[model samples]
Target: MLVSNVYRPMVFGCRADEPLVEVARWMVDNEVGALAVIDGELVTGIITERDLVGALATSDDPASQQAAAYASTQIRTAELEEDAREVARRMLDAGIRHLPVQDRGRVVGMVSMRDLLALETWTA
Candidate 1:
């Protein structure tokens, strides 16, 4: 199946300098693992649950930290028309669970390992 068949188009995001606490709270409230770090129309990075844990682990004051400080800046992206399996393989090779889904250089959504696995499970 294509990524478009598996991924939703709701791209939840925040500014690069958004507070880490607020980032985590948004994830919790939305039941998501990552948030795209958006600056205008650009996706600067992605901040995940793992990033939050690392930030909290190392910070003396987690609340004072910003999402951009811990986000994965070397972003691995999946095109909206790409195959789900191809995207999943790329993610595994990069050792990442979350990837921004882009179309025409604009981030349209996100795809996660969990989303791909669920698709696999359903297809099987």
Candidate 2:
């Protein structure tokens, strides 16, 4: 199966300049674990639940911090056309739970480890 087959098509995101508190609220409201940090039309980084937690632990005032400050700029991504198994391997090797799916330099979706495991169970 391809990554596009199991990835969530609806990509949720927030501007890099957005406040961390607002981004956290968006995450809670949307019930999502991560969000793409976009600057202009470019996907500069990603902010995950772990990132938020870290910010909460370290920052004296997380609300004043920008989302980009907490985002992981060196992100590992998966291509839409990539094989599901390969993507899963990459995720495991990198010790990451979420991967942004890109197509021709544009982020199209996201895939979680849970999604891959669920798909594996379903196919099995």
Question: Any residue pairs clashing in model 1, and if so which?
Answer: none
Models 1 onward score TM values of 0.96, 0.95
Residue 105 in candidate 2, Cα distance off native in Å = 2.4
Clashing pairs in 2: none
**RMSD (Å) per prediction:** 0.9, 1.0
lDDT by residue (tens digit), candidate 2, 28-90? 999889999999988889999999999999999988999999999998889989999999998
Q: Tens digit of lDDT per residue, candidate 1, span 5-98? A: 8887989998998999999999999999999998887788899999999998999999999888999889888898899999999889889998
Cα displacement (angstroms), candidate 1, residue 81, comes to 1.5
lDDT of each: 0.91, 0.92
Assess the local accuracy of residue 113 in candidate 2 as a C-alpha lDDT between 0 and 100: 93
Residue 25's C-alpha lDDT in candidate 2?
93
- The CA lDDT at 3 in model 1 is 94
- State the lDDT at 18 in candidate 1: 95
